[model samples]
Target: MSEEEFRESGGRNTVFIGRQKPVMSYVLTTLTCLNNSPDVILKARGAAISLAVDVAQITIHRFAPGLRVADIKLGTEQLQSEEGGTRNVSSIEIRLTYPPEGQGEAAKA
Candidate 1:
């Protein structure tokens, strides 16, 4: 979801959507979300699924080693395009649960 959509979700801001940004940027975002909530869900589609995994790993290993991957969900979304009538895209949701002991400072270093 977009930034506006995320805000419009009514206080449900624990989700981080992976995009074509630097891995560290995504890592920071995930850490920020984790600081605010008990769990942060990283969602990505297609090629971004790999990036999402990398962000989760880096956030766990580098910033919050105590963090746990509570769950992982995989699915496919069908989208319609002008050229291609319909195409299937892979999607993944990695749920990183349990905030670090040092909450607010998770992303400081």
Candidate 2:
């Protein structure tokens, strides 16, 4: 990716945060980011984690022909709730990669 394309993203694994939006919206965004970078990451918490997986699947299977899931990390985050109490929220990170020529599938990490 160019310096100015996604400056704040810092290149390589550009990140996309999941939310209440439709799955296709995220799918398109990941595809667009992949156009410039070699890898992309989709992150989500709580109920949105499932939507993140759907977005990754749609983008890898139906959209980008050669894209593959490279890695996946799951954990929990503690955050202060609106009522002032702490909460543990489940989170996930799906790293999607477009392997170099002749390195597909075998290059998964």
Candidate 3:
């Protein structure tokens, strides 16, 4: 969800709700398909969590080096069925936060 949408959800200041919100809600939007059997889990070498989590975590790390293990939050994970539907797979949707406002532009530098 967009930041605007998230803030509109509820509450007064529209500021983030928790200490973890800054890191947990950051996201890079993309769609990818897993080419393996739905039963197989994605693996990342030399990283924490499962391979799937590593995949997402590493991507975030490429941008946000300060990302702590505790900062990661797994949302929803699913497999695309042969019928073009989604099955709830073991893989998860990972979210990472972008740095504060001005840093967004700097991150691209």
TM-score leader: 2
Candidate order (lDDT): 2, 1, 3
| lDDT (Cα) of model 1 | 0.75
Question: What value of lDDT does candidate 2 attain over all alpha carbons?
Answer: 0.77
Evaluate all candidate structures by whole-model CA lDDT and list the values in order. 0.75, 0.77, 0.35
Ranked by lDDT, the better of candidates 1 and 2 is: 2
Give stretches of model 3 more than 4 Å off: 1-49, 60-63, 66-88, 101-109
Q: What local lDDT score does residue 74 receive in model 1, on the 0 to 100 scale?
A: 91
Q: Which candidate leads the pack in lDDT?
A: 2
> What tens digits encode model 1's per-residue C-alpha lDDT throughout 1-109?
4335434543453555556579999888888877788888887777888888888898899998778888998988776656968777787778888755675345667
Q: What TM-score, computed on C-alpha atoms, does each candidate reach?
A: 0.75, 0.79, 0.25
lDDT of 3 by residue, 19-55 (tens): 2323333223111221121112222112223544534
Error of 1 at 108 (Å): 29
Query: Which residue pairs clash in candidate 1?
Result: none
Minimum summed lDDT over a 10-residue window in model 1 is located at 1-10
Comparison by TM-score, 1 against 3, better one = 1
Show model 2 residue runs off by greater than 4 Å.
Answer: 1-13, 105-109
Question: On residues 1-109, what C-alpha lDDT tens digit does candidate 2 reach at each position?
Answer: 2223323544455555657577888887888888888889887778888888898889878988788889998987777778999888887788999877878765564
